[model samples]
Target: MQFKILQLVFLFAICSAANAATLNKQVRSLDWWQHASFYQIYPRSFKDSNNDGIGDLQGIIEKLDHFTDAVVDAVWLSPIFKSPQVDQGYDISDYRDVDPDYGTMDDLKELIQKAHAKKIKVILDFVPNHTSDKHQWFIDSVNGVEEYRDYYVWANAKVDDDGNRVPPNNWISNFKNSAWTWSEERQQYYLHQFAPAQPDLNYRNPKVVQAMKDVLTFWLDQGVDGFRVDAIPHLVENEELLDEPKSNIPGYNDTDYEYLDHIYTKDLPETFDMVYQWRQLLDDYTNKNGGDSRIFMTEAYSDINHTMLYYGSADGSQLGAHFTFNFYLITDININSTAQDIANTVNKWLDAIPEIYTSNWVLGNHDKHRVATRFGVANADGFNMLKSLLPGVAVTYNGEEIGQENGEVSYEEGQDPSARDPAIFDKVSRDFERTPYQWDDSTNAGFNTGAKPWLPVSEKYVETNLKKEKADPVSHFKVYKALAQLRANPTLISGDVTVKAVDEYTVLIKRSLNGSSLALVFNVGNDTATVDIAEDVSKSNKIVLTNVDSSRDTGSTVDPSNLKLEAHEALILSF
Candidate 1:
């Protein structure tokens, strides 16, 4: 009788262990973004369907197949709101209407419907920090309209003993001028962190906050999946207009804005409170609508400690941002970064965020230099491997899959106001990175047939384009597609990530869930390297994918004892 009782107890224990594992796996799979990848589209540069030499909503609709081909789960668009084209599309003149240059309201709605039909989500860019001077609210505030007088930040000028009137404070604009612009009509100065045409909104006013929330609801009713909040840290500033202290660090360029610490001008504590309130609103919307919860990501490029705070408290009760943009990966990792350095940097970011919130990785964006140009073409595949294999959401800027480099733009052709300034012309221009996408090696690179493109196409488009790369089996575009497809595997999406530095040049990433495991090895150097994987890999493991030509041997078992890697090569193995 005693032997029989012991056997029953042992079997019950085994069943309990198996059930716990299954439950954990089920919970991890519920995160929507974990199994998805986002593609960012700069609408004005994607395609021009109206032959206006500018991209519009109709242009994006015509190329929806491109997104389907790449298997992207969502498309994130830059600002398309009505604007005067001062800062491209960032300076908004109307919060609720689509820009005439981009298209009409009906065009935007049709794009959303078609995208939803194809199982693709659409995310709009939301700019709550400021608005164009042409916006009605700003115009009224400047004109001293009773109802809108305090809608913007306005202060009286200070007079010195010498009888000279000056700006309210010594704060400087991000584009290199006084943050306070003197308004002749109102006899007071208005604050503008960016261009003078874009005036900052005063969040201290409850009416202003409610109005912006209404703007979000107006779009939420239109069925946008979510929003990517722009310049989140600049949403609120110190109430007291104070002078910023000079920084000990050298300026990034000749711009005067970089010479100061920006202590009193940006990243104040009140900004996080505003984020929390926004999150509450998003949550309330999702609960009432009854679908996948809406996502709210922020562009908070501060230190890791502050960035994590945007995700709210560690307990996950007061959630703020679903994901905070992690710029450290782009700013810290470079060609000279060793395997150990990369491992430490990635792990530090992962550790800072709590388990309740999802993490995100961004390699390229409209505001920064292209990754292919920053890191050599030979290393692009290795970087892509790292980005997709990380245990989080990966954001790929348009044209990055084909390894597009920055196009050249002379001073006369530059459109960015900050870049056009004589003092910072060559240093601050972003036109090169914001050129039109190269679809084929034909006239205008097949982006548009009408008048010349808004920005010149890259000269190398003749050889490096979608048509050419798609024809070649061993192209960077093909490699990216394969990596993106791998996200469909639950183990790769929701597994635990562990980084191991094999050597100065080689790094190994391991992801595991339940009993299934996968390993990715990258050689981020210019020389060939071999890593012994006898303990980590076995004959049972198979090479699922690789960028090295020699390692593409099919139907052959990989040797566990001696794994070889060529320069700038990456391989994925499943066991």
Candidate 2:
């Protein structure tokens, strides 16, 4: 009864705050991500000044206008926190300080202020799941200080149901290794759910949750608009030390393909409560200046259907967005089945989740190959159109506007673990995903002047650079700009989504807010497929945008039986 009452009170608070979230707080010419299109920068590969050969925080500030090249409303920088750089800055050595390699706290403050001046809010990466081994907390814990020791999960051995089990527990790390690592100094196996260098924090401990909450507070207090919570689901593993028995979820990923039953660990019920607490913190901070709280979109390990629940506030209130539409996951393209898969997965959440203040969407990130490369297209215009036209707040990764393909990296250049175990990794290639941004045809593709880029720039940089594309009005950059700018139009961002096939080769959608409607036609085929619109759409409504075949001649042969579309193209129509 106490747990039930506690849960009810928490839910009540979440609902109340979520209702507040809908207040539609606008930030200096920008709406709450509704009128905004976000662009993600790897930071290291965005730009480099001082010829330091690494992209610095100052470099990002210098090149802030570059994102304006694509009309993005916000910029999300991958982790620049003090780190050992083991997981490319995902492992934070310190929470409050900026990494010298990136720049200084002053530089970051300047970046935020400057971006806000451009009407672009800045969102930083928050890695609450784990910390770098070098973090003071972890260092102090190894000293057998019971205070910090319980801050992380440390086990002597997993008590197996059978006597002869080797690992004691079958739970495997997403990075494909034993979840527990032997810490010689502590003389106990500590949980390193990712790499030995990155230790997972035990959120089951009140102090652990409070510590992470403090981290969130530190950033929000610094005027950050939001956070992209990294690996959110793995924060609290089962205390019993359980793993997936390797039953049915096959072909989903090789990352969890090993023989470990994860039933007793991961995706625990408390995880949702943790997100609630984080959401509450975000909510309180958002209301700090009498505005909506910072967004709480998490990259929790849940699949499409499971993520919607995260959007719900802890007290049955609406949580912030939990959307992640990654191209790396759906690299395979088929006209009929892929279209259905896309529609089903997306619509599932759109229907299931409430009208939360935020919804999740993405094109590419640092962890996957460029969307252009993933789509097997030298230019990913068709796919980008498909992704952006979805009825939600969409995010485009760096270099995606120009259809940046993946750049090649030698063994030394690859910073991700997925790149390390290439044999085990089923690569349509994830390494291509982490290549340096191709900004211009300049010596280093406009990323840096130094000979050795941290990662090589795409050779396509010559044609893909913003300089050339800006002049060629038909560039993907322009298309994305148009689509992004329309997010503020009320219909696209806050409309009811109705996705249906216009035909076998074309998937059609309607984003309707009130009675005003916008219908998008995506021709995912090679041949021009005719789509005859027999719906309420009449020839009188103006066609707002066209991506596949540019001519939006509604009066010309676009009837129910004769509607047509070109191959691998998408079109958005608003009335």
TM-scores for the candidates: 0.92, 0.86
- Candidate 2 lDDT: 0.68
Error of 1 at 246 (Å): 1.8
Tens digit of per-residue lDDT, candidate 2, span 1-575? 11221232343333234434432342123346654577888888888876677788988988888777567777888999999888889899999999988999999999999988887889999898889999989998988777897878887754455863244555677677677787778877888778888988888889988888888888887888888778776767777775556755556543463455465565566776787777777767666666544775677556544565566543555454444333323433432355566666556656755554355566568776666765655226656756665655678888888777778766655667644765644463355677777767778987787657776776677877777766664666666665655555544555567777666667777766555666667766667787677674555444455552354432122444466666776655545
lDDT of 1 at 477: 80
lDDT of each: 0.82, 0.68
Candidate 2 lDDT at 167 equals: 49
lDDT of 1: 0.82
Best by TM-score: 1
The stretch of ten residues in a row with the least summed lDDT in candidate 2 is: 1-10
